[model samples]
Target: MSLLLERHGQCLCGAVQLDCRLDNSDVSACHCQTCRRWGGGPLLAVECAQPPVIGGGDALGIHASSDWAERGFCIHCGTHLFYRLKAEPHYAIPVGLLEGEDWSLASEVFIEEKPAWYCFANQTRQLTGAELFAEHGQPDDA
Candidate 1:
C-alpha cells in the first residue's frame, strides 16, 4: 500500500498560491553557502516533480541563482517561493511555504559546508557537496 500527500500554500502577501504534489512526506535541508546566503540559513525543502501551479504570475519574480538553478519569490512581499533546476523538471519548495504536518527530516545536503553554530537533532542521511554533485552532475560552468 502507498499514500499520497498534497500540500497547498501561498506567499507572504497571499499574492501567489502553490499546489504541490510531493514525492514523499520527508523534507530535506540544503546547507550549501548559496542556500545559506539566499535564505540567511539552511533551506528546508521538499522535492516536487514539476513546478507548482503558481497563482498571480505577475507577483512572482525569478532570479537565476546559479547556472543550473533559479529561485522564485513573491515580488510584493519578498517571500521565498521555490528553487527550480534549469536543466531538469526538478524543484525544491520551501517547507515553510507549504501547509502540511506530514513532513519529517529525511536528508541534508552540503553537509561539509554546514556551519557548526547551528545544528539539527533529526537523524537524517547527510551528503557533502561533492557527493551531491557526483550524483546529480555538476551544474554547467555557464
Candidate 2:
C-alpha cells in the first residue's frame, strides 16, 4: 500500500494545533542570526504543500525580525511556530511543531553565519554564504 502523507503538530500549550499535507520529510536547519535568536538553535523547518489548518492562528504572535522575514510563535507559551519569508509567502513550519513523531529530515542552511560557540560538528551540511548565493544569484560573498 502506498504511504499516506501523514502530518501532525501542536503548539507549546497544546492549545494551538495543525494538520496538513507534508510533501516530503526533508527539513532545513537555518542558522541565520534571526533564527538563532528566535529558536535558540537552528530552526528546523519543513516546507508544506499548503498552510497547515491551524487551530489558533489568532493566538499566534508575529515578529517581523527583518524586512523579509517574519516569525510566529505562541503568545502564551512562547513556542516558535513558523518562519516565513515575505518574498516566498510560504510558511516554514518548525519541525518541533510535530508533537509526537519522528520529525527529523532537515539539511542545514546558512551555516557560515552560525555562531562559533555552538558546533554543528556532524549534524548537517554547512553552506557558506558564497555557496548559498551561487545556488540562486550573486549574493554578496563578503
lDDT of 1 at 46: 96
Every model's TM-score: 0.93, 0.77
**Alpha-carbon runs more than 4 Å astray in model 2:** 1-4, 121-123, 129-142
What is the C-alpha local distance difference test score of candidate 1?
0.89
Cα lDDT tens digits, model 2, 18-111, are 7856777767778877788776787878877767777887787888876656787888898877876666547788877774465555467787
TM-score of the candidate numbered 2?
A: 0.77
Worst lDDT run of 10 residues, candidate 2, spans 133-142
The sequence of per-residue lDDT tens digits that candidate 1 reaches over residues 86-105 is 87778899999999777899
lDDT at 128, model 1: 83
RMSD (Cα, Å) for all candidates, in order, is 1.8, 3.4
Q: What C-alpha lDDT does candidate 2 achieve relative to the native structure?
A: 0.72
Candidate 1 weakest ten by summed lDDT: 133-142
